[model samples]
Target: MEVTPRLTWNEEKSLQKLLGNVSLRLLYKSSVHGNSFGTMLNKCSCQGSTILMVYLPNNVFGIFVLESYPEMSEHLKKPTTSFLLSFQKNKIMEMTAAFFNSTVDLIDNKLRFNFSQVQYVLLRSNTQNIFIPRLLGEKLGLTYDFKSQYTEYEVFRVEGMKDEPGYINRIAGATPHRDSLLAELRAYRPYADLVSEIRILLLGPVGSGKSSFFNSVKSIFRGHLTRQAIVGSDISTITEKYRIYSIKDEKDGKSLPFMLCDSMGLNEKDGVGLCVDDIPHILKGCMPDRYQFNQKPITPKHPTFITSPSLNHRIHCVAYVFDINSIDNLSFQMLAKVKQVQKEVLKCGVSQVALLTKVNNCNGVLQDNFLQMSESMIYKSQVRDVNMMLGIPKSNILVVENYASEREMDPLQDILILSALKQMTRAADDFLEDLPLETDAIAGMFQLCMRCQLPGSRHLAQTGIADSLFETLLPFMFCLLSLRASN
Candidate 1:
């Protein structure tokens, strides 16, 4: 069998550089009710290199093949693979969003990882030159040719495309009820026993004391401090890498299982970091190739990239940390960044909350002035006339005074923890609601594709576009109804 071109050492290193430290672990579940696609790939064997397969049958299928150049494998540590096919602009956007949302889910669930994990991906298609590469290349302006002159092509099918076993699908293949889930999530009680995770992104410029605030929170958990601690410092020591904290609730002031993620403080150069600037690239690094696609867009057919099942749909809420006493008066600018993050969070149905750090030492006059500025911001940033944006109530923006005084810290800690838990509880409901909706969305999309009628629509129809559409979709719809009733 002929294989696709693999990236040279420099090329693979460049792609890996974009991924940062994140890695993924690929797990192929047993075949579900059917193995139509699984069977086909199983039979095809690569002549020179092992092809990494990311398959979510009835949902999406992606292929990752090693390039022909073995010279590239002699990188510093271990060599990496490059994606074979490219995607279009729109498809790239869709898949990139999927990767971000899904990675959050996986990380929240605490999955395993390896250094030589599946990095690059390919979307398997019947034809060599599909729409995947063209769309992706156009979006990033990368040079790509699906029919790469350096690589040879071969057709291989699994022995029994229909008889494959041991492929189990996720969640019984049902559509989730988004609107209903949203409504139910709104009613989530803060004290309800929820066994879910919360993703707290602390974003701010350097010198905002983001690290101090996080350490203060840790101190509270460690019992070294009884009050809600807020650290006021001039600079931060955090350089790179994400710091994770596990928080829990206990009767003796020991609630374990709390996770705090201290991301690298944002600066000018970080604006374009692959993780921050190219959201898709970071997510793709976290995702397995099995969930990717190789098909590119062509005449008469709309090419949309798909992704694998995500860990969760919604982020509980975002906490924006701002220095309240900055001599430069950075509140307004901080508000703008918060708004930007709020918009991104809304995409996955999450809410945003503003955190005012270093409030204890602020003079009375500055306090009043800061409050007024914040209120004005709330007015401008407010999503709707009724109250909040994306179904979040306006009362959710939390302003706590983080001071070093033990006397002042007790109440602040209580209030902050309560607010954080409340926000997280609501987010969990939103996350659950989000998953089913995503599945239903894919089903709905495929249904639209099935109804599409162009000159050669019949030929496209034979690609299992319709049957695969229904198999995954109908179940999703049924599950949504069942969930609604239960709610």
Candidate 2:
């Protein structure tokens, strides 16, 4: 297979001769042909087993192995848009390279890919071996190797996320103390008259675990696996309407002192996903719960809006959610959009934190075993990346794995999620102190940091983060969050 396609769908006879026994179906054609994925899905009727090939504009090509194509029903049969034939036991299907915003990262027998990173994800699907190239080729085995010699897939190979590997922590397998961390989160209380709960505004591109973050936190307090906030795929925002989700204390059955305010997903394009202008309204708590934002540009003339929002309605903290594995996949447009949104957040003097989700993408700890989160230096490096790219203090970025496809609670996962919650809540507290963002807040923040016994704390000196007292306060805040965890 050459970098550029040597054949097209019109040359089916030649293609079939080359593919041999592997059944081939076209899921996507090029722009000139005007054939789209939606059209392809509607017309796809082949049953049982087949491999779905993705033909991109360039020579970019990829395929997914699907086992069944029974009649489409309400149930989500597959999570991947592309499908392929069943090849193994636990892993019923094989997902090779994916197109769209994010590509599959296949490294050392580890598979990290989010269909959301791609432009779209199909019906829910299951797979055991998601590792690209390696697992994919392992499925095709000798058959693919023999036939691939003549197909465009001969050159198929999985690529890494960055151009040159960035700074990575070498430490492995050691993590913060879990039981203690959970205890701290439970013991944490908001100290204020007007603010009973820390209202954190969750923001991130689609499929970044914004809603999952809420569910993960609530599950800890509920003492069971809970899916209180609706979860969606990478293609759309999981939680559409503006809603508030609060954790319920198990003993009292009353709401916790913290709440997560979820909004529409952030899109790469302007006027898509959540409206940029609406952010100010959301930050102010003017956007009412369940208020659906339309595509048309919003104006003040519209009714059903909060006219006189008080500090009670305003967001105390901002938590930016993102998939660590797909950080490289962030589109240039999306990056700019986040920075612009952040500028607005900074102006509000609200404490902000970056939540890196789908942490399984970074290291084997959360990938195959969520318990290994502490020992994974890769997770630490990912946290560092979020700090540099988004201008969040190094300590402000927390890595977490959301509950997905699992029905039971994992202790370590709960600890990571709770640690993040603790940090954000404290950041909110720092903001509520009413210190100016410019000068005195920095000294106040320094004093706050001195109070928290943060481990390996030096985020500010390391990152040289300045200009925002909120950012300066993150290291110390994280110190408190991790204090008991390390103990």
Candidate 3:
């Protein structure tokens, strides 16, 4: 049997394309036989895994050996095999020299390749040892050394392996948390690669401008106003459920294949909306009742909503639309609903972005006339009540006016939607990348991080002191709604 000699590192420099991936480098490091090869295996990330070492003359070459056998233990232990297949010093020297030129130190204890860095190195092993030059010689009708130790070597080698998924993570932003929603929210780029679809919910009460705004969003994609109303009447009874809309076209004009769930409008008779109530239908991976804990049902009459903790891991973000036309001052009920939204988000690990709609209709979303009302809502309903009740951040609240004739709702929609989506995508990507693989305490730490950094929390910071105080105070008004529900 003839064994091919290893090529000198410089001899095959032209074959640089062969060592294109990080995995191959690792494989060469693990499977080669030699003391020098054994030393190189220490640089790999596959700690505690048995490694294969090959002996070449100049330096050690080895890759993590994945296969194992009790009978081959002694052979596996020794770098050099003394049998007929023993490596020639010259062949080994050439292989080791190539590796030294290709490998470099990456953070402490980690060795990276000049080409690509791989998480796991896989080696290609074959019993047939063939030399590139001799193979070329045979094709050219040139007689070459068939068995000479100096001239013949088997196996052309290269390092670095390409991991497509790993490449995706590198391009996407890296975050520290484990929850997929948070990860999507945090990543810099849209997760069109990892997740095939995104679920969204458009929420607000009757006359809150939810429909008009929904129509506006649809208009952006179709290049015309919504021809027909998307809202539908309930067949079951007088009670009107909120309508659901799938935001098929992203703000960038990319179309989604399907419409998202839009809730029916809240009946005008009830004088309250079920924005929180419909949350269960908009999200995924949560039991109707619980994520981890039994979720409290949100009655239309009550302004508080609770969800199982696990809901946080599933749903990505919620767009809370409020009417700019209604009550210049924040109403206790409105504050209550906001609090309920905040609480549900926190409980289920969802990110919230607030939208104050209908600015144009009221002479301005914020008219001089509603200043007092806005202040009252800020002080009486929102600040000390709602936010105080649930400890939601004021930054999450956004004030928008869809009715502004001077500035159409399109800009507002673009800003709000883009901001929210950007935040969500960035958050989710970050969480996924740095997320520890360990499922124990590490997962808990990830969950905690998601709560504080979500878009809702970030927005709360932007609401300013007056609005913050208003949100804090509004929860008390819920007492009436809660009491009314019980009655």
Error of 2 at 171 (Å): 18
Alpha-carbon deviation at 389 in model 1, angstroms: 13
lDDT of 2 by residue, 203-250 (tens): 998989998888888877776668878887789776668887777878
Please give, for residues 411-446, the per-residue lDDT of candidate 3 as tens digits: 223334333344434444433343334422232332
Clashes of each: 50, 15, 109
Pick the winner on lDDT between candidates 2 and 3: 2
Model 1 spans > 4 angstroms off = 1-195, 226-239, 249-258, 268-275, 278-309, 312-314, 331-340, 361-394, 403-409, 427-487
Q: For residues 384-457, what per-residue lDDT tens digits would candidate 1 score against the true structure?
A: 32133223454544444442544212322333433444455454445434545554355343334335432332
C-alpha RMSD by candidate, in order: 27.0, 20.1, 24.0
Best by lDDT: 2
A best-first ranking of the candidates according to their TM-score comes to 2, 1, 3
Q: Over all chains combined, what TM-score does candidate 3 have? A: 0.34
TM, every model: 0.35, 0.51, 0.34
How high is the CA lDDT of each candidate model?
0.34, 0.57, 0.35
Q: Name the top TM-score candidate.
A: 2
